[model samples]
Target: MLSDFLHEYFLKLSIIVAVFGGAFLGIGIGLVMRAGAALDGIEVLALYTLKRTSFTITEIILGINIIIFSFAALKFGIETSLYSVLTYFAATKTIDYVVEGIQAYTGVTIISAKSEEIKHQLVNNLGRGITVYKGERGFLPGKFDVSADCDIIYTVVMRLEMRKLKNLIYEIDSEAFVFANTIKEASGGIIKSRVKH
Candidate 1:
């Protein structure tokens, strides 16, 4: 009934329907998987294959999807298959966002002479906890024998807060060497800001 209605009214807008349908399907699947449930046999197969193979879950799923779509193209038409592929792509990305979370986390590392001030600012202004490692700097070809003690500052921040953190650090010390890595998952410590009553 739903398909008949959509086909009658949305034949001209099939692309939009396909993309949105795929996205909603992905969101549902992601939620189900997060709740420790499986909705598709392919996903179970992928999980089983994950333990025995070097392929990532995403790669495994994509490979399976390709095979399925190839058969679909042979049975249906190229246009239909292409639309299905687009839907699959949209669904895959939506699943990633749903599973990983909308707010992505990044691990940032800063090396600077003004580590103390940067640390203070990050803690007070950004409301972020940081870890400091004592390390030596100034190992150059000409100054191989010379070195100085320094503090390496590391912190985890949301992707949205990355720009603010970088700007704050650079504002304090323009030459501060700052780098960040995408964190797949993070827990513990002061990752969440304390709520005030």
Candidate 2:
């Protein structure tokens, strides 16, 4: 009876370890990406090779994972391959979530013909501070007269505000041009905009 109890206890402990170990490995991989570094392991070899070769990272990772899975099946049988499959899925999904979160909070740049109006709306209406850059813009076949003074607006807003801000701009000028991308890290000069939550 005591031996059976011990056997069950060890089995439960082993299962717990396997599940959490997989999750921990996934978290560690996420941290490396956050740090703008690669996770130093067999899984990241594809990432490194792709960077060096200037090939697509997604394609390389997919190819390498398939090869690894096949090798695991041939050498260690299906059980080992199965465990690796679980770990690979968990790590990739977790890393993607973290990377997306990082991107959402990055700064935003706005290019619009109604630069002054947008600037006023952002600062006074939205209560968010912004910077302006002088520039010129022209569109269409043969109409290339530049603005005497155009403003390029830059601001950092929370991820949640992105949709609302875009809608606001569209309401004002449906023809407005806008683009946004993720930034890894930022500092100095109030990155957080003051918004009424």
Candidate 3:
């Protein structure tokens, strides 16, 4: 009877450790959270990587989750892998929503014929500074026509400002080629003016 109790207790303890350990390691990526605890090991690793590198916390978490889930799938089965992926996503989203709200940034690039007008609007109207790179565009892959010189207007802005900026871009130059990418973070620039225009 005593031996049976010991065996059951050990088994339960092992299972508990396995489950909780995996979940905590997989989820607690963004370190130093609300419950008054400093990060260690994996959580700290993720947080540090996020701060120093271009990767976001969510991305780092997802990458780790994928690695763990891959190992589980190979050792266990496909069902476990799918379940783990879903669990990671749901937990990541919920935790991020509750703990750290989404940090959204957009990198806007504009190539326009009317560079002066666009620059004026972006500076005076939007109160945004832009970096212009002189480059040759208009070289179609299919055509042999020579390229035309244009200024590559690049700026990083809050996602909320994208729509307004886009409208202004189109209004200024209907034929402007504009593209945007979701960036992880932006710093050390006149990202936004304190004095609203």
Which number leads on lDDT?
Answer: 1
Q: Could you tell me the lDDT of residue 8 within candidate 3? A: 94
lDDT of 2 by residue, 87-191 (tens): 665556555556446335646788888887898888876777788888777766586773445678888776778887898778887887788765545667756
Provide the TM-score for each candidate, comma-separated: 0.71, 0.56, 0.64
Q: If both were scored by TM-score, which would come out higher, candidate 1 or candidate 2? A: 1
- Per-residue C-alpha lDDT of model 3 across residues 44-154, encoded as one tens digit per residue: 666778778877665676678788889989989976686667666655555554444444678899999898899888888888878999987866688757678898999
| Residue 140 displacement (Å), model 2 | 1.0
CA shift of 56, model 2, Å: 14
**The best candidate in terms of TM-score:** 1
- What are the per-model C-alpha RMSD values against the true structure? 6.0, 8.8, 9.3
Name the 10 consecutive residues with the lowest summed lDDT in model 2. 54-63
Compose the digit string of candidate 1's lDDT tens values, residues 1-197.
99998877776688888899889978987787667677788788877897899765556766788789989998898888888887777777787777778787999999999999998998888888899999988866897778889999999998888888889998999999999987877989988654343
* CA displacement after TM-score superposition, residue 35 of candidate 1 (Å): 1.4
lDDT of 3: 0.73
Task: List the candidate 3 regions with Cα displacement exceeding 4 Å.
Answer: 1-41, 45-55, 74-76, 91-103, 194-197
Candidate ranking (TM-score, best to worst): 1, 3, 2
Worst 10 residues of 3 by lDDT: 29-38
The clash tally of candidate 1 reads 0
